[model samples]
Target: MSFSFLPTTNSTTTTTTSTVRMLPTRRSESHSPASRCKSAGHSSSSLSNGFIHSIPTSAASSTQRVNHRQGSLDQLIFKLLTGKPKCLAKVLGGSGVLNTSKNSVAIQTTPIVERDVVSSLQNCSEVRYGANSKPRITNITFSTVTSATGLPTVPAEPNKARSSSYWKTEASHSQSSNNNDTHGTSVDLLRKLSVSRKESGSHVDTVVTTIDGQRYDTKELDSDPDFQEVAEWAFPIFQISRKYPKTVLSRLTYNIFQQAELFRIFKVSPLKFFNFFHSLEKGYWEIPYHNRIHAADVLHGCYYLSVHPVRPQFGVAKSPDSLLPAPQTPAASIMSQMSTLELMALFTAAAMHDYDHPGRTNAFLVQVEDKKAILYNDRSVLENHHAAESWKLLCRTENHFIENLDPAEMKRFRYLVLEYILATDLKQHFEIIMTFNDRIPDMDLQVESDRLLVGKLLIKMADINSPTKPYGLHRQWTDRICEEFYEQGDDERKRGLTITPYMDRGDAQVAKLQDSFIAHVVSPLAQAMNESGLLPILPGLENSELWINMNHNHRKWKEEIESTYEPTTTCNGGSVNGVIEEESASTSDSPDPRRDSPSLDSELSQ
Candidate 1:
């Protein structure tokens, strides 16, 4: 199929016609104007491929106008095909037939089938029409019916002459498809670019690698054989302090990371865990009874209670002193109901509960007007400091262990930590015990709040479990606490300040204090927990050897007091010691002179 135009003797008159024939691949000799047309005003040019273009001319002025019209037709065709009308026109007008001043008129093309137009011009390949041709448009192929900027042109599908609306619809569809492809390609390119940039440095190559189905960049710590050894160690609390006492910090890190892996709750890089543990350990003050070792102990206690099923130990029979009416439910059944996240929160709170403690009681701090007391307005000063400082450390870049947690999970984690840590304050002890006492009968471990309350009580039990340890360990902790208290009392005396009770070095009796603590605090707490069936009789409880040792120590204190002085009634009607008076006056059947003594009751209270 081809088209041609022939001019008559008068330039204003022309005829256009079409012919259909099988296009041959053979080239033909270029035809001159006179050869193609004998009309005096007609001129023709034949392409090597046998296509003819004819024009009409009268004089020099009309010939220039004809050339200008030819150039305009060429520009319009190029623009319709390539979607850049002005760019092609600018290039051609500068140097093509339209460059002459007299050649300023534009030509209009006859109606053409849209499909044929697309098939004929889809090839954007460059072609040189003449030596003077500056911007060629031939021999180029575009895969889609659109230009470089993704704008649609003619449709590739063959169709008869279609309305402009039909072409517009097809063009819109083509534009949408092109846009989708371009957007997808752009995203893929960006991803590849990011990966390449990250991997470009040797540092990245050295630090990041896969391990046990996760990636870690922890300075090769994960590869260390010792890490595996320590991680797999059973009973980390017992082993950590005993085997590697001086390496408490390292042991804690290994244990925490190992637990995270064991429970499958840790999904972050090992580096983050390591950094958090390091910062946490470094934050603890080196106080005698509340140092890193104690923190590790508390953490170990929490971990033990969390994972171990409450089973009775061998060689230990049911204690006659157990507050439970019968053999209550096993501790394992209650512990089994706690979630992995709950266990993690409990362990973390234990490890950080006493962080940065100054080895002083809250009461002492308040009475002495210590800076911390002033900062916290004399309320839970140490507890508040621990929670705040520990949370701050976790927020640092390297120590963000929980950074991957979603917003809700993170908020829950923070809440658990704060609740458990603050519960350790002794001022809250009576209230917590009362709450537990009230909730024990119908306590359900399946409820999250109930389970959390249990966790809180467990942490408190662990905090004060020192006196329930085996006699040797019990003595060690007791001495440490006493020494800490006496130091406070000594400071008080040096400043001529009123000495805090149980803290005065000269008058404070260690055995008497232990006895009172066991009777008033430890015993009642254990009884409440046992009745609630929330905890089993662990090794260091009132039903274990700890209770027996406590009684023996108490008896020894009683014997010392009795032998020290002769019985006497003072003008105040009180005995020399409070404990002696309470035992004699409360238990004795015979009415003594001080039986109804108000001063005796007052002295006993103090």
Candidate 2:
């Protein structure tokens, strides 16, 4: 079969009609006639009686010209069927339409046509025609044949034509089969087109085709060689960062953006997204903790929780003492019910929830009458400041990543972001947990409002997930946070203010403090999440790793404490009993050394 475009003119206007001609197949020199007949099938024999139908095209401007070109049958079929020039460009594997005038309509081929044309059109006829034969009359329409791209191929002969009902039935089945395939192909094509355009140094707007063949303009996908490398780094971001120290931040951001397919969904500019992330990264204080690294960790946690099955990871088992039944819902199911906007809000909130933190508690900021404390009436000072500062940075001209959002959408996004961020405040921790416990037992995620509440709870969980990590990582974070706390205590002491309990370098028992935190805060929340069916009881959360490690460290602290209490005896006598007697005598005459000096400072500071 061969196809050509014909330009026809009337006195009033001109039009171009595409004509397809089925020709007789002659046996190839390389193949015997029997082999040719078998390969070509009855379609070759039926082509002798096939007819050509003239379908009028919409009128084009006078300057329009029909460019007749010979190419692959796939290209011809795609060009004849797909109306969009962008689809044609993608299928043809070109950056764009080639050499065309203002009035010319480019017919580009897409990858979707590759398999469709080969399967459907190639086997369309069942009989062969002579090289020279007069055209015969046939009531067949191109619409039925064209629809075959989305339908099962029909075998046809000179005297047989299927009914429209049969064509319709096959078309429905074909559409269902090709839906996912077409969508995947479109995305691949768009990515390739994006890469090709960048390589060619073209600054033209990129036209991306969707699964249903709808086209929209998008910025070119990042063509950096590391883009793919970043996209494949899924989770445990801290480990990935440690492994790739230099590129972790960039990789993390790119991976999240690509995995969510946010670039395509939001039609965001790649440069703008990167600029926003860089600015947000810079906004974090270079403190021992509560910095960009923590933000990244939280973002990774949020992403994993959002995409993975939460039930198996945090659900209660069917034990006799279990408070809640095993969770029937999967985290992925809840996540699937969330809108793209909601997911974006959750991610953005996780990354910026602690922006510009000064490594001081809210109480310290309020007690010191810090400017930020006064700015928000000393209520959730750090949380309020983080939300405000992050939003302000996002609105800056260079970092307006969501500039394309409609006004209402932007407003909703801002509200969700601030809500999630504010929910991260430690002061609000109990209240959030209470709310989660109250709702989770009978919560139906099918309700949109319930899903939103769950999303908020997820961000909160992510904010404090450090304790749920592996023992080594958890220890590392504990050390970093303790250092930050100690620094704050040092600052407070230097200013003649009382040091907070956990922050006091001279008096704090790091292990005891962590043990208390795990028992009173982390464990309760984790238990609630699992028992309430909000999260599954995965090994990470329930296998006693964190508690065992914390207890081990606590025992070491107790040992050190006991060692500090050992009597400071002098060698007053050669015998051990005489030394104890002398030490008792010294202890009676002098102030207790243990009371005078604190051992926790030296041990914990180490």
TM-score of each: 0.52, 0.56
Write candidate 1's Cα lDDT for 455-537 as tens digits.
98889887877654544566677787787778877887898987765677788666556655655556556555644544443
| Ten contiguous residues with the weakest lDDT in model 2 | 577-586
Candidate 2's C-alpha runs over 4 A off are 1-247, 312-334, 536-606
State the lDDT of candidate 2 residue by residue for 374-461, as single tens digits.
Answer: 9999888888999998888888776677865644456657777887898877666666677866765456654445566678777867
User: What is the TM-score (0 to 1) of candidate 1?
Assistant: 0.52
- Global lDDT scores for all candidate models: 0.48, 0.51
Clash totals in order? 6, 25
- TM-score winner: 2
Clashes of 2: 25
TM-score of candidate 2 to 2 decimals: 0.56
Tell me the lDDT of model 2 at 139.
Answer: 18
